[model samples]
Target: MAQWYQTWNKPLKNILWWLVIIGMVVSLPLAYTRHQTETSANQVEFVFDYRDLLDISDIQTNPRTFVAEQLKNMKAAGISSMAVYESTLAELKESRRIEVYNSRDAAALTQTLGDPNENFTYVLFADSATQQKLEPLIQKTFADLKVGTKPWSFKNRNGLIIQMSMDDASIKGMDPDPMTLQMLKDQGFQIVVRLSNRRPFVTNEMDRLLKQLHDIGVKRIIVDGNEVPGYTEENTEINLNKMADLLNKNGIGLAAIELLKEPQKGFSTLSKQTNYNVVRLHSFTEKDGEKLTEPLKKSELQDRIQGVADRLVLAVKDRNIRMVFLNARPVKSLDKGKLVDPLAAYYESLQGKDGAIPRIQEVGFKLGPAEPFDVKTTGWQKIARIFILLGGVSLIVLMVSFFVPEATLLLFVLGILGLAALHTLSANLYAQGLALSTAISAPSIAIMLAIRSVRSGAAAKWKSGLAYALWTLIKTSAISLIGVVYEVALLNHVTYLLVLQQFRGVGVLHLLPIAIAGVYLLFFSENNTYRDKIANIRSILSSFISVLWIVVAGVALAAVYYYLSRTGNEGQASTLEKLFRSFLENTLGVRPRTKEFLFAHPLFLLGAYLSVRYRHAVYLIFIGVIGQLSIVDTFAHLHTPLHISLIRISYGLVFGALIGLVLIAAWEIIIRSWKRWVPQLSK
Candidate 1:
């Protein structure tokens, strides 16, 4: 049976290669559908946090004048929307809508001794307009909380006396200030309401709030605190479904903030209930604003602002972010002996020459209210994905055949069975598993083929060797892109695009292909027969350990650790590297990845050229794995647009090849000079 299975391995592998090709052809249209979905929403919204503006304005000598000036500045800077948070007593005080005092303070103002037992909160309206607009809202909010309120007057200014302590009264949640919303609307600015789950969930109250917001043309709501609005009531009669229904009925969508410490509680459920009507938002936090304005010299400040602009542009153009939320805080400038804000810098970054607005508009986006992606799936997608699934499985089996040629058919059977079981358990797990497997397999196979070509023979001349190296690089990249196609096709869902779901096994995708290539190089590169390869591996395993070997192993391990550490978004970059990266972004609208263009591709190119002549240079094929894997890994970033990823990888290949040619020329000169001047030393 074993001999028969071994005999069929060659034919089975040949058949699997065809399956991979067919799968790639079938997946192309699926990729096109994803491209269409990505391009469906092209409007971006710039939203300023109104609460942060109010807080910053509080530090100014003329708070109202400062706010009015900033509002005009914001409009000039292309900010079209304001994010309004749910009101609290503290916020109302900041806005100067009302003043609150404890029982003792009220007694002092009245010039009468206070009763020792009375601990009521006193509210005095800023003006008649404030009194008329806020009195009902304050009364309703306290009524819902089962707290009593009575009318009062201080010097002819009507106010409310709440039968609760100042501390307790200040924390209660109220509706967003109607006056502020109406004012923002009248100013031609869109409204984005931020809701928190701190208040007791009341169906009628939420419905009324949503309806009022809808009347003002409010399109989206962002959840505040740690939970979405109705999360606390999920287990009760009022659940996320009901909340989602209210939002849907009121035509209000949700804004999914990117990179929160954790996703808002009940957000996923609410989003689903609302038919995935969600736009991705990227927030420039108050801390980030302060850092940008931190007492830097003129040049450094310009660089920091430019860096911020670059990030915002990328967030919109590449990462599917349609909402850019800007926050500002007053920074104490000891040098200037006053509080300064980054508002000016922020405005300039948006509307100045070479700013984010032009760049964003250059990339086919307009400043407007952001809309969610119109995700639609066709019936044909299901049918095409079947072929993609088959192709992915066959590719994995073909990779296994490289090491266990005799078990190719058995592995295919097992892969099919295992995938079926995985699909039964969870379709998402199946897709991610197949995606990761094919991601590693494609690059490993591509590098192995390059190594095989190297083992065959060296080119007779430098020119021919350089041509062969370039061809090999192109071929390897093309092969690696098979995995890219597989990944894009399998994970083509709005959830992945929104980052609600992620492509798992990224660390393995970055590390495993290189390890597999390294293994093939150690035991199988020179051996033509499986038995010989097994013998070579067993001999190495049984060999005595050496101190130098251990040292080399330790160094290799450390290099690998550092390499893996730099694989994800959380990876740290040095200041010089950040400057270099910014330079690349400024120069090339899309920055090619550093590892590919600088380290992986160039070395792979040089290695390919040199391996033609020198046997030891074959070891560079291990380095070649990095470029191939990176090409595939680039697509694994599901949020980035397909066109952007394609352009980035294309640039990586072009630039990497050019650098590799220079290295090849330099190597030739050194070799020739050594032979001419010092033949004995060269030998």
Candidate 2:
């Protein structure tokens, strides 16, 4: 049975390779379709927070005039939209649309003492238009909560008295201020409604509100709280589907905020229900705004502005963001003895030669209403994905077979069974698992193949070795990109593109390939037999510990810990590193990753060259694995456009090769110097 299994294993492995190649060929069209989808949305919107602007205006002596002037400034500064939130009494007061008073203040205005027994909330409109626009909305809002209201007069301005404490009445939620929306529209700026789930989900009321917004030319909305509009935890009837239906009826899509602490509840379901009419938005927080406008030197302020512009440009050009939300606050500048706002700096960042607007336009996006990607599916996509799955599983089995050759047939069978079980559990989990498996396997196999080729040939002279090393680098990167194609094919859904779903197992992708390559180098390289490698491993395992080994182990552990720390988005970079990144972004429209271009790719190229002659230099293949894995990892960021990742990888390879050539020349010089001088010194 054992001999028969061995006889079949070799042929089975060959079949697996064929299946992987066929899968890749089948996956190419799917990847191209995804590329088409990514290019569908080309317009970007810049929206300023209306509430933040209102807060800034409150500190001015002429608040109303200040707001009007700033709105004009905002429009001139390329801010095309204003994000208006649901109204509260406090917000209305801040906007100068109305005034709120408790019983005591109302009595004082009338020159009478407070009526303690009849404590009530009072509101006075700024004008007849305000009164006409807001009175019924306020009345209906409070009446729904069973709060009583009656007509009141204060110095001939029409007002209402509510039978509730001032504190209780102030917190009631109402529809977004109609006056603000109309004002924004009249100013030639689009309106982006901000919705919240603070009120009860009433279908009739929501329908009316959406109709009103549609009339005002509102194109999209963003949820302001932890849940999407109409989501209710305790009410099964009030769900995202109902909200999606209303949005669809009104022709308003959703704006999904980027990098929230926790994803908005029911957002994913709502996105799907709306047929993925969702655009990604990146927000400049009030805190970030304050930091940008801090008292700093002219050069420092310029650097900060450039950094912000680069970030915004990348967000739109590379990460599929269609909306940029800017927030602002008044900063207390003790040096100037006044409160300062970031409006001027914000404007500068958006409207100059080096501003975000020009930078964005240079990259093929126009300043207009942000729109969702036009994602379409073809009938052949599902069939192509099946081949991709087959290829991914075969590649994984082949990687395992390297260590367990006799069990190649069994591994392939088990891979099929495991894929079925995983798919039964969750289709998403199955796809992510296979993607991660193929990602690891492709790089490991590529590096091992290079190793085998190196071992099969005699060492070459430096002149020919240079060309050989470059060829090896190209070949290895091509193999790794096959995994990238499979991954993109497997996860070619709008959810992944929108980041509603993420590729899992990033840390494993970063770590496992290097580890597998290291193990292969130690046990299988140089045509070593399995018995010889097993004995070598046992001898090392049984040997007594040495202090040098312990020290080396400690250093390796620390190195690994640091490497893992830098693997994810949460890694902290130093100030100098940030400056360098900014410089790179300015010089190169799309910055290749630092590790790939500067560290991994360069070292990998050098390793490929050195491994030709020095037996000990084979260890560099472990480092080379990093470049291979990184190539595939770049595509794992599904939010990044396929073309952008390709450009970045291409830049990494070119730059890495150039730097590798320099290293090769420097090493050659050092070696010749040593050969010429060391012998004379010994004599």
Candidate 3:
């Protein structure tokens, strides 16, 4: 028998290697899909209502102070810097100006003529209407005085470059009664003026406008994501350098805001340039803006807002940029002085602190560490619970060893009542269940009994090699299917919530009785004796741990369950997935179902054959029920209703019985051939 077993080692080794290859093939795609679902992000930096802060400005007298004070609030709120959009105010074609009708015709007439230099001159028109009216005649003399309106939308757009002053005529209503830029500078805010309405007019009024901007506090000028006059692919470098030199002469610097540009390349190039003091990127994200604007309940909106901020924190970490300009416009207007930091509330929620400025130090610069989204227990608590559950299981093992059937049943009823009473007394502490405990313990007891049965039936002389081979197969198959069952529950409840409160803890106590009976017959029986059981333990444990196929299958099934059924999990799954789940519930009012058709009945026949062929394998009968237990246990989840669990059991009985019949026939033939061949080989 030993020689015969030795012949199969090479094939076993080959199959073991194949298992690794198959596991990777099945698991990688599932893992990748799950990662995709979990790791999505929002690209915006902030999500808030600008109107929410108007009433809280430190300087109430200056309307412009609201902008400056709010800028300070952002810094206090942990924003590294900010990018403010600037005006595209165009002077009438005939004069030096900052405002004109937001129109396509005015856009075309103000085009600057010279290859961007300090020497360019501007031609002023009496009015933009007159400028377009005389374009036919004006073209003859001033060929370089360009005019068109490709940039401005028909909708009114006021160009407030920065809310500089209520008093400046040039920026009057655009930034009337707004925050002071100097206040932002005094508070150590790195201010970036994004050139929103890009030039013909920017270059047309470049020198004087830039001078006025520099005298106050504006330093860096954002040149990207803005269309400048004659901004061509070939002249990008020249245009960028010219803008930098213009800002440099005013004791200012250039900043690049990458909107649609390649992030790494744009950031890398701008970062390397000495004149570029601050390089950043800004775009309002969809989920951060539009989605949040949808008609959601107040709590849902807050959750979405926090989600956006978390993604923004991640975006900063990923890009290593200094500032992000989230379009705060989409954030629905809030009540004046609601004590919300609009965007900062997101980080505050995670840290559980108000107005915290801590940055995510590891990400180099960010709002702060992402906080735990859910509550979790400490390690000692988990260990203590496991100990209690094992104690409960151990009690059942004791009962089966010492008590008669009637006594065991009677005590179980009393114990359950006592437990329910205790649960009521400790309602504050929550109703604790032994489900996880039983989920773990039932398979162990089943395997242990199956092995004890094999040892008890062994030849009077121990260590019959042929007998060991048969025992190994039975052990492997039983242990392999442990905790293995088709998942069919309709709810998305996690089956193992440690803090669960329910009366179901007593239900799993039933397994304790089975464990007890098996313990007496398999280990402590007067007929079988302890010495024989001791002889079999090593083989049983070795076979249990060493079977690779079952271990791999168990792991694969776990991943599949998580991938398909986890909360927020979506697959190629739809109604069909629901139907597949329902099909496994193993029940019918008058007919048998899945469990009976696929597992229990077949297990029963196969187990019966194995038990009769090898008396020591008699525990296969209970092990077969363990397979049924696996089915009921799955539906036995607290989240599943009890009626469904019974239906699932019946399904298992019918389907399993059918499959068990087939497995029995195949196993009978295999065992007969093995027995016949063993005698011939023994010679």
Which scores greater on lDDT, model 1 or model 3?
1
**Over the stretch 1-683, how does candidate 3's per-residue lDDT look in tens digits?**
55554464324333422432332233333223322322222122332223323323322455454555556556556553444443212212111222333223233554424233222222233345534533333232122333221222222331221112212222311210113244445666545554532334334345655676676556555553535322445655565455545555676553334335343223323332333244334345434454654556877766555555444543344333333555432243354332222334433533432111233333233342121112222344333333332334333332243323223334444545665565567732322333333333445444445545544564233444334434543453343223222111111121111112222443343354345546655455435445676766655667745479788879967854653343221334465643454333111322233334554345545655565456654555554544534543444343232333455555555556556656766876898999999999999
lDDT of each: 0.89, 0.87, 0.40
Q: What TM-score would candidate 3 get against the native? A: 0.31
Clash totals, every prediction: 0, 0, 47
**Per-residue lDDT of candidate 2, residues 84-144 (tens digit):** 9999988999999889999988998889888679889999999998999999989998999
Question: CA shift at 68, candidate 3, in angstroms?
Answer: 7.4
TM-score of each: 0.97, 0.97, 0.31
Please estimate how well model 3 matches the true structure, expressed as its whole-model Cα lDDT: 0.40
* Over 4 Å off, model 2: 1-3, 235-238, 455-463
lDDT of 2 at 216: 97
Model 3, position 452: C-alpha lDDT score: 51
Model 2 scores a TM of: 0.97
Candidate 3, which ten residues in sequence have the lowest lDDT sum? Answer: 486-495
Q: How far is candidate 1 from the true structure (C-alpha RMSD, Å)?
A: 2.0
